[model samples]
Target chain A: MIKRASAFLLLAAIAIAAMPSAALAAEDGELDAIHHSANAYYLDFTPIGKLQLPRIFVVQHEDGSYGLELFRSTAAAILEGGWVAEIDHDGEEHAEGEEGHAEDGAQEAHAGEGEAQETGKYAGITLAQLEGHLVPPGGGHVVLDMSISKHLVFAWLGMIVVAFIMVRMAGKYKRGVGRDTAPKGLFQNLFETLILFIRDDVARPNLGAKTEKYLPYLLTVFFFILTCNLLGLVPFGATATSNLMVTTVLASFTFLLTQFGGTKDYWMHILWPPGIPAFVKPILMPVELLGIFTKPIALAIRLFANLTAGHLIILSLIGLIFSFANMFGPTVGYAVAPVSIAFALFIYCLELLVSFIQAYVFTMLSALFIGMAVVEHHHDHDEAHGEHHAEPTASVA
Target chain B: MTLFAASLLAPDLGLIVWIGLTFLILLVLLRKFAWGPITSALSEREDKIRESMEQAEKALAEAKQLQADNDKARREAEAQAQSILREAREEAERMRGEEVNKTRDQIQHLQEAAQTEIEREKQSALDSLRQEVADLAVSAAEKILRENLDADRQKKIVKDFLSDLPKN
Candidate 1:
């Protein structure tokens, strides 16, 4: 049973990893799929088909009143709200915005909408890119789109999963299974170990005595990022961590926490290094301040890029098989499948490892940054520097 | 909305807000529902184990001290018993010597008394013999004077009397 399950798991992993490129091969992929598999507002259960999510928009009316619009699906939203697509005036001359459909493609989308008018979700509501915001093409200004996207939905699901696991684990611990005695189950043991790792290995070493204050954020980020990353690996799921907005928010939390938690010494060091010669302070000040901003940026990008790159490589590898088919023949495509799958499987495993590593990196860096901020530094100049660099000491570089 | 295709890296403001809210909510949730109990439990368990360990060490030290005291007491008792036994033996020897000396003195005293008594008896007997000899000599002298003088017999009696006298 175990063998079969494992084989099925391996096969399923390869297949899920390969599907994005396959879908793109059938229709050349968009810019979105390069980093992470993009999901439409529709949910795909694979065996079943698309499940169009409810569309919600808080719109600013032309008359200056606000309204909340809810539609069963995007098609319903367009049909009821009288929306259209924003087409570029010139041929292929467009600013950087949402995907620019070619003229023919635009018309097809219109036709699909016309056909879907009678039906339900054959088409979606038209959207136009206006200065990086997705506004209704000719509709009221969109103040906020609380619409559930692939990532948002997955994020909720991930949150739910984290909550359920943690809450249940909390219950067990509350009953004293963990506190009074040894933890009994695997999940209990695993979470305990991971939590302790974050506490002792990450938070304590970095944040020191004030570790308890920032530990919750560290743990939350870890579980949240880890959950999002793993959830994306599931069949028909998109990685929320692969999204820039998601990673940015996670990093910004650390950034805000670090800033707010900053001690006198932390701020002083950034604003003015103690031992540096007076003349060089201004020159080094910008560099020091830039380091602060760069830390979180690096944190955000590191997580986003790592997760996105995993899918990109996997999708490209799968794309290779089709490219070979086009180059040689069906025979070559047939021959390429095994090699493509083997490499995809290898990369899939690597991606799993990377997922955890990325989560760890994100959490660790956050703690370190917060540690750098909140850590109390002694007034004895060099000793102050030494204090921050004290425990779990390593070159931050 | 097929809107993500335009620019991949552009920040989704809606998502940013949603994630911000979601993450904050999650932080509160986990902190309240999960981490509060779990972390406290872990630390509580740690403290309990640490306390038990300290208690064990203290107990062991106490036991070793008790053992040392027991050994010392046992050693002292053994030494006391040895001294008592030696004292009893010494006392017995002294008593035996005293009794032997007393008995020897008593025997010596008894022998001296017996010797004195025998010497006195001998002297009295000798003195009595001397008196009897003197009376006999006087009486014999009277009888011989009264009966007529026989110088040879009288001389023989004197010689026999002198020969019979104890050596002075």
Candidate 2:
């Protein structure tokens, strides 16, 4: 195990060392495609772009009433619904022409200079321009554009896949395929192994005796995170786990479970520590309270950052090839191509590992936190009260 | 530079709501269809495995017990066969000794009776021969000397011969 780890470390180190040579002076279009986080809610095929998902928006109208609208594409929304891009909101400027972008100062700073305006087919010009700046139609009421995004679509896709696979596995198990007999075939074996792993390696150890009670939730979370993470690695696929809102919701589940799952003993230790003197309790209570919030926040941030960072690094590494080509000449660009691709491939492999590891880490920490809340520790056996008789409720499985 | 350097950093509240609702629905649905059956099946499989192991152990113990019983029965049968063989050998020896002693007594008695019979027959033949010889001598003396004293002489000769025999 240690040998494998060292080999991985060496390869990663070599890739990092080789990366800096060509990581400069990339074209505006290349950087925007690779580095810029904002992408139109469309599937970018291998050479360029492909299918665009439906655009759903919660927009406010001139009548001061919010409305939900759906469009087949962003172009339809703009042309049919009279929605305008941020740059064209006042009707003061036509879409920027190709020659005009060369003279435009602000557009020159951002790599994708007038790329959105140059295109006549795609709507909203570029989502980056519309960031927090979507004006209501006729400027009559406040509008919160709750538009369905690429990541949201990916999130639903991940959820559907997880559900489909789990339901099938569950059906197999229900049919005694793996119960009374030895687990058969690839799917059943994989099914049995993964669930058993969570039960044995993750749930049982962390949650102790309460492992059975919370096993369902732990299994769901693990598989859901795994599916979402793996979905991101697919070509033209957006990673839902990289999104803050999605991770926040997932972590919030853990937070909710941990807080509500807490026993009186667990709360007592935080609210009023037994062994500590009265003077020390005041100073410790706030810290303990903050700890409750921090656990989930940390869970959320850790997953989001790890997933997002891996994608960014891979994007940056691939961007190096174009940067080199633009900087020197075609020969130098061709020369650096192999090295840049090699590094990007290495980072890609690392991201693959990170996907599984991050899912595992999130599930493990969630289990640990839940266990801390629910499991009755040996230390909280004070013989003070005979009155409190509420039955401790175990959190949802 | 763009004002939002971290464009993806801030989460939209609507997205959170969408995720929250989606996850809740997923949790409820999964708990019913997926987790319920999956966990129960897993536990059922575990129970089955444990029961199978216990049953196998029981069967092994029963097999071992049967082996012990078989050994014990074999030992008892061997001991019974050995005792029967010894009894048969001892009875044969006793029968042979009794038969030998009775045969020896019977042979000794037969030998003694035969000897007595032979002695009596010899004595009778001797007596008859002496009488015959006395008659013949009488007849010869009468013919030769024409004397009537032959009968008395034959009788005296026979009596003298019988008296002289120590066997009487």
Candidate 3:
């Protein structure tokens, strides 16, 4: 077991070490670890190069009319199309026309002389500058940049993979593999275990009799988050769950379900809590109200931060080797390689564990929140009486 | 750096719209295809298991009841058989005693009859002997009378002697 584990970690370390070189190449030889985790317009398949996704923009022309614009890629927009980079004037107004860069004032002045001859707006700026900051020609701004991004593609992949696996499993059940008889084989058994875990351990315990109603959503979110989380750990793959927008949307679904499915008892507990002292109700009311929104917000932030933090740490640990190499010589870099790889390996394993944990936690918490909302509170009176009964028992014991 | 940080924390509209749209579709699709069958299948399996268990228990109880009924009948039959045997044995003993008493009575009655018959026969024989002796005495007396006395006087003497011997 130990041998296999180390070998797996070694393979993972090699994969991780091989990764940053591609990301580094894209960043112009700078080890900006943040760049790897950040959202981008292209999928970075390092060693092979980057694939630019299509860019779609809702644009407003100088005539104050709205129009939709489509480009095959950032390169396409700059070269064939009429869009140019919206470079914020950094005093580098001139450098070179051929290089398409305006450097410092001295170079900008040199390029400005050349700019006088050229009339096109795309004359001075390079493709790198024009990549993310594209603007419509003739003094118009982009209204909405509805471009497909790298993370979005991976998120779709996660969704598709989950849908395929689940549909196949469901097909087996529809044919009476598990419905009439015992579930058979590894595929059915393995997925059944996860599905059962989400249902029995996660949903049923909290949602109670309403488990059936909420179980589908719980199962979907759990697998979705897990797949997205694991996708990030693979080479050249982005973590969609690490994105705030995705987490927010997920948490919002829970929030909506909680609010809509809430019983009168749930609202009553929040609005006018039973059995509280009359004076304390005023202070507690706001807190209870705030709790409704806070729960989902916390849900969003927790999953997002957990996923993002793990990626950040791994990136940073890998970034250490480069930092050491720059500070010392190549010899020191080589010396620090094993240490950084080992730490990265540890974090990677933790991340694999965290992927499952975060998925479970998110689903469990969602079920709990929804359960709180929908569950009938017959225990309110019992709870008061029980506390009274509990005190005397404590004294007797 | 600040722009980079802003972009990092920024919620992109396009991504949010995309995620919302895709996730909703995912939920709908999965709810229909995946979770629907799986959960129902599970519940169906549970129900089947529970039903078969109940049936097995019912069969077991029935078998136990049948066994008890069989045992009771066997015991009742044995008791009846025991009484029948005892009654047959007692009747046979009573019939044998009656037969023995009847046979003894018949033997006693035959013996008494035989004795009576023997007494009657002996008396007859005695009478016959007396007659013969009387005749012999009479013949002797007649011969003596023929030689010594007259016939009328001899006959009268014999008659008177016969009468006086009986009286004596």
Question: Which candidate achieves the best DockQ against the true structure?
Answer: 2
What are the TM values for chain B, all candidates? Answer: 0.58, 0.68, 0.60
lDDT of 2 by residue, A49-82 (tens): 3345566667677776777777776555555666
Q: What's model 2's TM-score?
A: 0.79
- Report clash pairs, candidate 3: A94-A107, A94-A108, A100-A124
Q: Which parts of model 3 have CA positions greater than 4 angstroms off?
A: A1-30, A86-127, A379-397, B1-3, B87-168
For model 1, the DockQ equals: 0.26
Q: Please provide, for model 1 over A1-397, each residue's C-alpha lDDT reduced to its tens digit, 9 standing for 90 to 100.
A: 9998998788676556546534443322222245236534656543344466777788897878898878776555556655443444342223212344454444443443343333334434332211122356444688887777778898899999999999999999899998899998879999999999999999998888999899988999999999999987776777899888899999999999999999998888889877757998899899989988998998998998898888877776776776576558879877987887778777887888998999999999888888878988666775555454455336445
Best-to-worst order by lDDT is 3, 1, 2
TM-score of chain B of 2: 0.68
The reply for model 1, stretches above 4 Å from the true place, is: A1-36, A85-139, A382-394, B1-6, B103-168
True contacts kept of 2: 0.55
Give the range where candidate 2 chain A is weakest over 10 consecutive residues by summed lDDT. Answer: A388-397
> Which residue pairs does candidate 2 place in steric collision?
A217-A397
lDDT of 1 at A169: 94
Clashing pairs in 1: A97-B6, A98-B6, A99-B6
Question: Can you write out model 2's per-residue Cα lDDT over B1-168, one digit (the tens) per residue?
Answer: 122334567547767877787788778778899989888888898998899999999999999999999999999999999999999999989899989998999899999989999999999999998997898677555644543368787677566655664564
